[model samples]
Target: MRMQVDDLSDERVQALIMNHLESMALHSPPESRHALHFDGLRQPDVTFWSAWEGEELVGCGALKELGAAHGEIKSMKTDPRHVRKGVARQVLAHIIDVAKERGYTRLSLETGSMAAFAPARRLYESFGFTYCEPFAHYKHDPNSMFMTKEL
Candidate 1:
């Protein structure tokens, strides 16, 4: 798959993001659903990427600079048809590479704690992201699990 920085304007990318948001809503309450919307991903501190295989969109992920040395992973989603095909893993690896290139000392992420998010948790764990307390503006929440990895 080819990974590229995205402007989030393509209808295909927009549809994937909408699906990501809707899926999060089903698994977490509104207050606990931290997945960013399209506009949120466009923030100055955030860098978004999309994975593609020719004409098909495979997955997407984003990195948000929380501070000069700390970064947060956001908006990771794989196309339903491409799950278990390594789309997410490749996209995540790309994000980590970009974070390292940006000189971040630590990378963290927030994901749902429910069963619906087990695969996501495992994915992060495979990337060496271990459990941690909520970072940045996040607070205590039973439904949220925070993970971090030192670069």
Candidate 2:
């Protein structure tokens, strides 16, 4: 699969993001869902990437610059039909590489603390992410979990 920077104006990317937000809503309460919308992801601090197998979009992920040496992972999602095929893993690896390229020393992410998110938590763990206290503007949330890794 090839990964490319996404402009967010692409219809396919928009659909994928919509699916991501909808999925998060299904697994977490409104206050616990932290998925960003198009406008949010389009912020100057965020770099979004979409993975494709030829013409098919397989997955997407983003890294948001939190500081000169810190970043946050956002909007990570794999197409429903493509789950378990290493799509998310590939995208995550790419995001980490980008963070390192940008000279970020730490990368963090937030996900739901629910059964539906167990797989995602395991995936992050495999990537060397460990449980951590909330960073950025987040607080202690019973339905949320924060994870981080040193680059």
Candidate 3:
């Protein structure tokens, strides 16, 4: 699959974003769902990417610059139809590489603590992310688990 910086103008990407949002809401309570909608992802600080297999969109993820040395991972979602096909892994790896290239010393992310999120947590663990206290504007949240990795 090929990955490229996404402008979020494609209908496929928009639908995937909607899918991600719907999934998050289905699995987590309102106060706990942190997935961004299109407007939030379109912010200046966030760099979003979409992975494609020729004409098919496989997945997408985003990196948000927090400060000079830290970045946050956001909107990490693989198309349901393409799950277990290494799409998320490639997107996440690309995000990490981009963060390192941007001189970030740390990368962090927040996800749900529910059982539905087990695979996601495992994926982060495999990538060397460890459980951590919430970073950035986040406070302690029973429904949220935070993880971070040093670049």
Candidate 4:
């Protein structure tokens, strides 16, 4: 798959972002859903990437700079047809590599606490992220699971 920095204007990428938001709403309550929308991903601090296989979009993820030495992972999603094909893993690894290259000493993420999010949490764990208190503007919430990894 080819990973490219996205401008969030591609209809394919927008559709996937909508699907991701809808899935977040279905699996987690409104207040607990932290997935960003198209506009949200366009912030100066956020860098969005889309993975493509041939001419098809396979997955996408984003990295948000939280501070000089800290970053957050956001909006990770794989195309339903491509799930379990390592689309997410490749996108995530790319984001991590970028974070390290940017001199970030820590990377963190917020995911749902629901069973539906088990695979995502497991993926983060496999990358050496451990449970941690909320970072950035997040606070304690039963529906949210926070994880962090020191670079």
Candidate 5:
């Protein structure tokens, strides 16, 4: 698979992001739905990437700068048809490497606490992220699980 840094203007990338957001909404409670909308992902502070196998979009993820040294993982999703094929792992690893390259000292993320999110939490754990209190503007939320890793 090819990992590409894609601007939000790319139609294929936008479609993938929309699908990701829809999937999140379906599986996550409204209060725990943190996936960004299309406009939000286009923010100057966020860097989005898409993974492609030939012409097919396999997965995508994003990193948003929270401040000078901290970053947040956002919009990690693998095409349902491609699950268990390491697409998410590839996108996540790329995001982490990019954060390190950008000089971020720590990377954090907020994911759902529901059982549906178990695989995602496991992925983060495997990448060395540990549970943490909410960072950024997030407050305590029962539906949310926060995790962070030092770069």
Candidate 6:
């Protein structure tokens, strides 16, 4: 698979993002749904990436600059058809590498606390992220699990 820094205007990338958001909404409660919509992903603070296998989009993820020295992971999703094929792992590893390259001291993320999100939490744990309090505009919520890793 090829991982590319994507322009948000690219049609294929946009489609992949839309698919991710829809999937999130389906599996996550409204209160726990943190996935960004298309316009949100295009914000100035966010850098997005897409993974492709041949001409097909396999997965995508984004990194959001929260402030000095901190970065937030966002919009991480693998195409359902490609789940368990290491697509999410590849995208996440790439995002972490990019965060380190950009001089970020820490990386944090907010994911659902529901059983449906077990795989996501496991993935972060495998990468050395540990449970933490909310780090950004997020407040205490039972529906959310916050994790952070020092780079």
Q: For model 2, how does the per-residue alpha-carbon lDDT over 7-70 read when each residue is reduced to its tens digit?
A: 9888998999999998988888898888999999999999999999999999999999999999
30-132 per-residue lDDT for model 3 (tens digits)? 9988888899999999999999999999999999999999999999999999999999899999999999999999999999999999999999999999999
User: What RMSD, rounded to one decimal, does every model reach?
Assistant: 0.6, 0.6, 0.5, 0.5, 1.2, 1.3
What lDDT score belongs to each candidate, Candidate 1 first?
A: 0.95, 0.95, 0.95, 0.96, 0.90, 0.90
For all predicted structures, in order, the TM-scores are: 0.99, 0.98, 0.99, 0.99, 0.94, 0.94
Which residue pairs of candidate 4 clash?
none
Which stretches of model 1 miss by more than 4 angstroms?
none
Question: In each prediction, how many residue pairs overlap at the backbone (N, C-alpha, C within less than 3 A)?
Answer: 0, 0, 0, 0, 0, 0
Candidate 5 RMSD to the real structure: 1.2
Off by over 4 Å in 5: none
Model 4 lDDT per residue over 1-151, tens place: 9999999999999999999999998999888888988888999999999999999999999999999999999999999999999998999999999999999999999999999999999999999999999989999999999999999
Model 1, 12-102: lDDT tens digits are 9999999999999898999998999988999999999999999899999999999998999999999999999999999999989989998
Two-way TM-score contest, 4 vs 5, winner: 4
| TM-score of predicted structure 1 | 0.99
Lowest lDDT 10-residue stretch of candidate 1: 30-39
- Candidate 3 positional error at 72, Å: 0.4
RMSD (Cα, Å) of model 4: 0.5
lDDT of residue 69 for candidate 4: 98
Candidate 2, backbone clash total: 0
**Candidate 6 C-alpha error for residue 53, in Å:** 1.2
